[model samples]
Target: MTYSASANRYDTMAYRRSGQSGLKLPAISLGLWHNFGGIDTFERGREMIRRAFDLGITHFDLANNYGPPAGSAETTFGGILKADFLPYRDEMIISTKAGYYMWPGPYGEWGSKKSLVSSLDQSLKRMGLDYVDIYYHHRPDPNTPLEETMAALDLIVRQGKALYVGLSNYSPEQTREASRILKRLGTPCLIHQPQYSMLARGPEAGLLDVLDEEGIGSIVFSPLAKGILTDRYLNGIAPDSRAAGPSAFLNPDELTEETLDKVRALNAMAGERGQKLSQMALAWVLRGGRVTSALIGASRVSQIDDAVEALRGLEFTSEELARIEAILA
Candidate 1:
C-alpha cells in the first residue's frame, strides 16, 4: 500500500522561527537519537516517521554517532526517506551533527575542519541527501579553535552540504564566541540544540539568554529527561523501558525516589491541565517561546501521537508556573 500524509497535517502543529532567520521549525520536531537505528525494527521506525510527518512534525534531527554502532541511524533514516518521504522532502527540515568519536583515528572526531567536513560527507552519504537543512557541531571541541569549527560549518553551507549551520551543547561564552565567528564568516548560526527539561535546567542559567541576545533559536532535546518525566516509570520500569535496557543514557539509578517524587507531583499537575507529564514537560520548555522547539525521541507510534498533542496545551497560567517552580525547587 502506498503511504500518503494526512491532509490536515499542518492544521494543528505550530511552527516557530529559528531566531531572527527566516527559517521556521515545527514546535515538536522528532529526533532520531534512539529508535531509528540499525539495531531497531525497521518497520516500526518507519511507522513512527510516517506518523510524525502526518502529525506536522516537519523537522527530523539526526547525528553521525546516533546509532549503537554509529552511523546506522542515518542509514535507516535514508532508507525510509527514500521509501516514503521523498515527495515531501522540500517540506521537511533534516538536520544532523558531528563532533563525537566516530572512528579510531584522531581526525575522525572533534571540531577540526577536516573532521567536520569528512563527517558531514559521510553523513550526507548515509542520509542519501545532497545537503541537510541544518548541520551542527555536536559539541565544543576543547582542543580545537572555535574559529576552526565555525569556519568548517560555514564551509558546509558554502559547499551546499548544508543549508544552515548550528551548534549543540555549547556553553554561553562558547556560543556567543562561535556566533560572532559565524557572523564574520557571513553565515549566521541558525539554531542551538541543548539538553533541557525540568530535570535538566542547565540552559536556564545562561545559554537561553545568550541565544536570545544573539537572535538564535533553540531546539531542546531530552525535554522529558529520557522518559523520566513521563508516565512510563510512575509505577516501575518495564522490561522494555530504556531504564531497563543496556544503554547507560538512562539507568535504574536515575529514577531515584526523590526524582520520581518530583515527577509524581508534576504528573498530578499535568492531570490538572489534562495533559500527560511528558506533554507538560514539553510545553514548559516551550512556554515563553525562548525555546523554539522540543526535540522528542519516540520508541512507539503512540508516543509520537502523545507528543504532538502537547502543542494543544502549551500555554500555562501564572499559578501553574508558580506551582511548577515550587515543585521543581
Candidate 2:
C-alpha cells in the first residue's frame, strides 16, 4: 500500500500474521499508553504515529484510561485520526479497551455489558471512527460474569463498532471462560495482549498453551521489560530513562544487584551475537511462533530505528538459547 512521505518508511518493518487469522500485523506496533496524552504536544504524537505507520507499524493500541488524567490519550489520538489518519483508515488497525476504572458508580468499569457497551461507544466517539479493528476487555473483571463481557463483545462486533474482539491481562482460566462464551456467541476472540518479555516469563507458564489450544493470537506489551533487558541499565539507570520517570510501572530500585548481573551476562551474550541487548530481548520474544507481535513504546525515533534493526538478527543457535537460559538461571 502507498502512503504519504511521512508513512513511506513502512517498507523496512516486518509483518506477522495473528495466529491463523487472515489479517497480518506489523511485527512491532506503536502504543499510546505513554507520551500521547492530552498534555503532550499533539504535533509530536502525530509525527510518531506517522513515523510508525511509515515504518510498517499498522497496529496502534489504546485504552479508555490511557492518559494521566484519563481519556486524554484517546482524545489526542482522535485528533490525529481526524487530521492525518482518517483518509487511510483502511490501512490501519486500531484497538481500544474498556475494562478499567474510568468514571464514578459501578457502570464505569469492569466487564459488565453496561460498562463494555458504554466504553466502546465513548471510544468510537473519541477516535472519530466508525469501527476499530479490535476492541478489548482491557482487563478481566472478577465481579462481572464472563458471559456478560462476551455478550457485550458480541454486540460490539454486530453493531460494527469493532471488527474483532480481544482480551488483556486475563489469566489462562479467565481467557478460556471468555473464549468459550465468545465462541458460543459466534464472535471469535481474535487476540490476547499481555506483558511478556525475557525478564517477565509469566505468559509462558500456561497462557501460551491456552492460546494455542484455542487458536487465539498473542500480542505482548512491555516486551523489553520496561527497558530493563536493554543495555541502558547495564551501566546504571540513566537520568531520563523510564526508571527515573514518575510512573510506577518501572522502578529504579528493581535494578537489584542480581538483576544487574543478569543484565550484564545477557549483554555479553548479545555482543557475541552482534546485537544489542534490547534487540536480542525483542527477538527472543518473537522467536516462538506463538507471539504475533511486540507492542512497544519509544520516546525517540532513534530508539525506533535500533529496535527495528533487531529484526535482522532474530535468529539464535540452539546453544545460544541454552546459554541465555543459563544466564537467566
Please report the candidate that would top TM-score against the real structure: 1
lDDT of 1 by residue, 46-130 (tens): 9999999999999999999997669999999999999999999999999999999998888888899999999999999999999
Give the clashing pairs for model 2: 7-54, 9-54, 10-54, 10-55, 10-56
Off by over 4 Å in 1: none
lDDT of 2 by residue, 1-329 (tens): 33364535566778877866778888888888887886567888887887777777889999999875589899999988888776778989999999889999989988899999899888888888888999999998877778888999999999988999999999999998888889899998999999998889999889999999988999999998888888888888888875676554577788899999999999988998899898999899999567999888877766777778888988888998999999998
lDDT per model, in order?
A: 0.92, 0.86
